[model samples]
Target: MGESLQSIVNLVDPYTLQILVNIGIAIVLALGLNVITGITGQLSLGHAAFMSIGAFTSAVITLRTGLPFSANLLLSGLITAFVGAAIGYPILRLTGDYLAICTLGFAEIVKVVFLNLDITNKALGLSVPPARSPIPMPIIVWVVAILSIIFVCFMKESRFGRALKAIRDDEIAAEAMGINIARYKVQSFAVGSFLAGVGGCLYAHFLSYINPSDFGFLKSVDILSMVVLGGLGSIAGTVFGASILAAAPEFLRFMSQYRMLVYGGLLVFLMVFRPNGLLGGINFTDLVLRAIGRKPATAEVNERHRK
Candidate 1:
């Protein structure tokens, strides 16, 4: 089945296939940010820094140690997670804008460090190996993306998730309930940063080149936009938003110089109408039934409970 799928994919135009792969990579990054900012309610702006670290780490591993791509992926994520824990420990206490400022500052520092690194060629960047997996690049990207979504969904339904939710909704109350706020916050960042590193692996492999400039402050803002556009705490929404934003530039290219203007306009329109997200709080089954002049039994039960 995998071979057949790969063969079918091989028939697609290379440029279009690369775009699809890009969408998958964006989804992974958005999901990671969703964990830190959405699920855990911690505002993080340094996500792109982690991605930069992952790309360099994996590329270096392959160039120096000649490790397989899979090992590089895992190792890169582990290394980034350790960095996240160490950095997260110091600044996790600040709330609101203060936390955001600290994270943004940290992101710039990482970028500057990468720029001066001899191994990275100091802004010249490094060439990365393409996907060396037994499976095709598209298939592997899809598998990783799907598995990430599933894992996050499951995590949201676990006891750890409940604690995170409480922390998000009411930090003081959560602490009163005996939740370890500091520990949980750091752990959440570690998990989120690990995923960001994995995403960097996919992204670097996709482009075959990466530099410090590639993961700058603007890149971090773009990622944060994906989460906000999708819906905070909404995994499916994040995927939806990432896919739309990823493809929007391609579709809007025909507008020439006005393309970005139109793109920004569209995001503003969506936020005005569906502030929660394009799919947040929406159940397809219930939506379809409502459109057909009927309602699902669960919908009726929920309405009754609300009353």
Candidate 2:
């Protein structure tokens, strides 16, 4: 099945395939940010920094070591998670706009450090190894995207997810319910950063080159926008949002220099009209259950109590 899928992908035009690959990467980044800002209700503006960390780490590993590409990606995520945990420990205490400012500052610091680092090849950037197979990159990228979605969905259904929602709803109330806000907040940050790192690895390998400029504050905002537009805590919505945003530039080529203005306008429209996002609080499972003529668990419980 995998071979057949790859063969079909190989038949696609290079431009279209590239767009699909980009969409996959965007989905990964958006999903990661969704975990932090959506599910966990923490505002972050330094996600691109974690991506840079993963990209640089994986690129350096590929250049210096004989390790396989998968190993490089995994190690990059682990290292970035460690860095996120270290940063989150103290910074997570700050909420709302303060946390956003600190995260933005963190991204700048990472960018500057990368700009000066010789190992990262400075502004020149580092060349990543090409994909070994004709369809290796797209396959790898989509695989990671699928895994990220599944991981986040599973987490959303778990006790941990409930705790996250509790904290998101009311930190004080969550604490009263015995949910450890501090530990959960740090964990959410670390996990979100880890996913961002993995996305970075995929991006670096797909492009075969990366630099600090590629993962700037603008990139972080782009990712955050996807999460916001898709609906916080909605994995399926994130994927949809990523697909639209990633492909919008291609479709808006006629606008040329004005495309950004159009993009900004769209965001403003969404914020004003659909502040909760396109699918805010709606899950795919709920849709499935409704389609099957069954109420979701919560709906069923409500009906039962009413009866």
Candidate 3:
């Protein structure tokens, strides 16, 4: 199976392969943001900050410790999760646009800090070690992306997931139901940041470079758009959204001068026409089940009972 997969990958052009890897990274970022903004109803615009943390941490570890890429990736994610928890604990008390502002500020702060840090090589950036195999990095990215999607799907159905949904629907009601709002919110933030960090690690290795400019507020906005465009709480929707957005720039390369304008216009159109996002609350699994003449488990039960 591995040999066959490698053979297929080899048949693809390098440019296409690069785009696929980018889509994989975008998927991870979109899903990570989905956990906090989509599921937990938290508004964070500092996701790229976490990604920078992971990318820099992984790059340093690769250069200094000579550790394996897997180890570096894990450490980067752990560190970013810790940072997310620390940040979320205090700022999560704020809600709505205020929370969004704070997170955006946090992203700017992270960018500035990295810009001045000598260890991060300052604005010049650091080059990462090249991958051992020609196709290894993309494969690793795809594997991580798949695992992240599966994990998030399962999480969306778990007890904690329900609590998050409840919180998203009605914070007061969720609290009344004995859900630890603060605890769950922090957990979601941490988990989401962890996934972003993992994506960052992949990105650093793929490009063989790291810089704060690469993870600025614009990057965060791009990731957020993917989650929103895909359908906030839907994993499959996020994947679809990420793929489309990731490929959009390449497809619009011919209109280089108007690319961003077109992209922004498209987003505005989507927001106006499909405010709930492309998939919204619809689950792909439920659709498949219905197509197969079967009811989804949740659909079979009374709404109150399911809740």
Q: What clash count does candidate 2 reach? A: 0
Pick by TM-score: 1 or 3, better one: 3
Q: What TM-score, over all chains together, does every model reach?
A: 0.88, 0.94, 0.92
RMSD of 1: 3.6
Candidate 2: residue 97 lDDT (0-100) = 100
How big is the RMSD of model 2? 2.0
lDDT score, candidate 2, position 86? 95
Best model number under TM-score: 2
Per-residue alpha-carbon lDDT of candidate 2 for residues 13-84, written as tens digits (9 for 90 to 100): 999999999999999889888888998999999999999999898888888888877777789999999999
Error of 1 at 222 (Å): 1.2
- Candidate 2 — which residues are off by over 4 angstroms? 1-6, 131-135, 288-295
Off by over 4 Å in 1: 1-6, 254-267, 282-307
lDDT of 3: 0.89
For each candidate, the alpha-carbon lDDT, in order, equals 0.86, 0.89, 0.89
- Count clashing residue pairs per candidate: 0, 0, 0
Q: In terms of TM-score, which candidate is stronger, 2 or 3?
A: 2
